[model samples]
Target: MSSRPAPPSPPRPISVAELDLDAPDGNVLSLRPAPGGPAVVAGDVYALVRLRGRPAATVIGTVAAGEDPAEVLGALARERLVAAGPRGDAERLAARSRPVSAGPPPRTSVVVATRERPEQLARALDSLLVQDHPDFEIVVVDNAPRTTGTRDLVTRKYADRVRYVREDTPGLAVAHNAGLAAADGPVLAFTDDDVIADPHWLTALTAPFTADPGLGCVTGLILPARLATPAQILLESHGGFAKGFAPRLYDPAEPPADEPLFPFTAGSFGSGANMAFRTEALRKAGGFDPATGTGTPAKGGDDLYAFVAVLSAGFRLRYTAEALVWHHHRDTWQDLRNQAYGYGAGLTAYLTATLVRSPRLLPALLTRLPRGLAYARAMTAQRGEPADGGVPGEHGTHHHPWPRSLSRLERRGMLYGPIGYAKARVTARRHGRNPR
Candidate 1:
């Protein structure tokens, strides 16, 4: 017999406090400062409460049981109701939020997980060496590569700033965990070896922590170094987050998210491609999960999961659009397709896990599926059958043409997130193996 469906959950209490302020739409939003005492930021909008300061029961997303906490705080921040307090407090908060002192500053460590992409790895390491934020160490966790050139290049050229750790383990999380152990710093910053950081990447990434005592994790925006592929063009056109974004924070707390949320606004979610974490919080959550990322059958949701865990544990998670990096997009169609499938699978696993934790989610989950598929189809169809490209600006970008048809197709596929997870699970079971 088939298993019985889970019971529906009761409506959650309002997780926020009513504040006396109007929203962006001029609607009044009830706001409350997060419970367990606020971290006085002086001039900032939200208080930076630390993980240690909060009760064990209060996860990052938990509400205070009356109104939406994030909504209220955001409204206050926007209205500038949050006082910077005194001038001394503002400078202190600013000092804490800024990057470590520039010359021979605190020893910040960077962890990188690399596979066969030697060129990408090289560029990433080069960027680290050039950061305006000084006094940092580099740890390159070389996953089981087909060749040993990654080790050779690091040791020969970037030996002073780098240490090579070899993890025969194939998963990205495993490699990252290995790096975590190898490095020693108050803060741990991570960047994909395939990405290039801006000169201010480290400084900007570390800046927020100093501003808010409660800040535990920070993420930055990712721009495509090359948005030349039909895959990328399609992805970005659908608000691919390349234009800088943030997440909603107070949408009825259920799980801790890597991104923040607003009552009516959506921001960019945290990308593992560009993120940093306080060393202590990173360790408490047991690092990244190996079962749900690119190196596994699920293909890639570990970064967000880790961020959620941190927030759930009562640590503040942040996204800094200013701390930017340029990631190289896959040029080939097959690679792009695979990447899309992998992305879908990762999202599915994340949502599925959420459903298991909170069964009353049928309304939101089911409602979102078809909308996702419709988006994918429309994106791909923009590719317009066979074409050299499209009319100027039709494909996007100030330079080059884009295939509108395929762009729509990819967007539509994203909506079928649940379907992708199902397919991934089936493939894993049938093959009894995970793809590399």
Candidate 2:
């Protein structure tokens, strides 16, 4: 008969405050000692609560084993999720680790705002279906599709896990609102159907709320699925969608910046491809302004506007790199150019919105314009120079000057975004199109 190895020495026993999970469906979990298993019961979810109610030292999920609990907690903390585990000795740990009195957990919802792409959408749905967190439901809002494959894929492979919603509206933001209205989760995560989320994406994305009561939203890092194209490489080189940390609820009214920018910024920027928000927060923010996103000629910026509103409402925003997702970048030069122009247009919209509220930021635009032009000119001249023997390469410019210039102009344009948006608001009023 096969014998199992002796159980490892038990770490110092610690006490968990108690398992308390208030699920949204009127389910309540109370921690009660189980006869032969982990202490603490939460309906189907049982907690072993080892080492004095602390998580076992053993690591879980796709991360490497023997990983430091602190690092794991950091990953969770980055997402602003609840993280409570032992630190030093059992006694020392007890002083700091406190089990949170969790209110009813948010019924998280997933919305995939998709365009015409089907293959990528299939991959994204596959990832969503395989998520370890199962409390959530998904809505794939078809945004004026050129093909019907997205609907078909959902009906076939993900019939159990997904609900397909078709929004004839052509804009990405509009499609997202349709999904938001159709969803039931108190918290909502919106991802482009073109991206693949790591299995832990949902958990990490929702962790922040568990830690801080005030946290209203979470944004995760978006690594590229493939960085083969020159445009993709260039975009990454310039830190596309990769943002420095910023504090969201930081009342400039507050005394000092206590936290690093990663998770707590007013404009906690992240790719629309990988971001989550509380559903109540979305409702309060009025469900993504359609004028700012893809529905308009401007390709994107809805996420930024939503982030801004969440911060303005005095809620915290967090960025979790461990909650990773991969986005497929446009492969062709033409696609890249189109993306660049669309981004510029979107920034134009965002800038216009920002200017009306904070007029002082208006000067930042003028300062950036000269610097942007200088960089563009220098890059253009270098690309214009022949690769060898003064002969121009087959591709007229080794690095296309126009896209790069347009990218710079777009960034510069953001400095003016608020002013421009405000101007547009006034102009729209005269034209009978309500800008607000």
Candidate 3:
């Protein structure tokens, strides 16, 4: 007997169009799809359009089954739902037309936490000195440095514009605490040595705090410095530091729905590279956890922990896409793999710490654990694959499978995170006793 014919292969996803809703001339968009190619479903395809370099809209279209993705996108453009043009044109237009704040910007204390990357530190310092916001100071903290090279460099090159401090502690949290202690401004902004702040970074970051005294934390957009390498592209495709272009306010009173982990999905809040805090609120929340960041066993989740702490303390957290910074990603595949592992380990450690510190949240954490695991697995499986129709902008056509070995390594790290965190706690206690 002849076997039934193999099931027909699934249709390949298509790259439809890029829309610019904030463009100067008008809303403009462009579509590129091969004729007679795969049919696209309207619900499955969408564009992540930006306004003034900030995530503004996630535009999804409704196309009939078996219809051309390009035609549907074009029709949407005509309806003025989205403008036709290249990806960043709208952002540029918004930048030019955007109005300045009426009053003087607040005094912001910019902190740069550095270890051994002196060259990168120099670039970061340079960016800070030229910020459009006038009333700000740069605080450079050299964390557990083997030598005084960073301090010396800062003294020689930026003595007039920057305040340099040295924290002998190795952990990122320790360095942050040191910076916080030294900062004089009411608003403290933190960026890594590997980041270059936009000229308006300070202005944008501090504005929300001035407008709302209740806001405790603010995170900005982090775009890639360059996407010329494979690793960089893959990292952004997997999920970059950018939260979106639109401004968002997260009030504890009005918690988001369907987030099983409420605030614990730390990565969603923002990256450590471009975040700011109200000095009073951060200090009251106890600053960063010494055991949770880089240079410690946890290897990452300090930023996440801080976000949760700020929210738990009854203060608002705002994500302002306009406060922009460019981050230099790890260019090598090995470094990227190591980063992935750190992320997994960090997340697990953060969860463990949450349970230990606040047992009341344990029930909520437990309720969310299974769903979290399922989401993690789903993300791993869909790492490089595009949706059935397509993803808008660069993500639509771009696909890169995360190496299986790397994915496994990250999973292994997640398994080890709790143990790592425990060890780190023990070490921290020992250090506390020794006073070294």
State each candidate's clash count: 55, 32, 11
lDDT of 1: 0.55
Q: lDDT tens string, model 3, 200-260?
A: 7888888888778899999997766554455765675556577766567888888888565
Superposition error at 141 for model 2 (Å): 0.3
Q: lDDT winner among the candidates?
A: 3
> Which of the predicted structures, 1 or 2, would earn the higher TM-score when compared with the native?
2
- Give TM-scores for every candidate, taking all chains together and pairing residue i with residue i: 0.59, 0.61, 0.77
| TM-score rank order | 3, 2, 1
Note the Cα lDDT for every prediction shown.
0.55, 0.55, 0.70
Q: How many clashing residue pairs, candidate 3?
A: 11
Error of 2 at 24 (Å): 39
In model 3, which regions exceed 4 Å deviation? 1-103, 384-399, 433-436
Q: Per-residue error at 173 for model 3, in Å?
A: 0.9
Residues 309-404 of candidate 2: C-alpha lDDT, one tens digit per residue: 666566767665545565666776677666665655565565455444435556754555565446534533333332211111222222422234
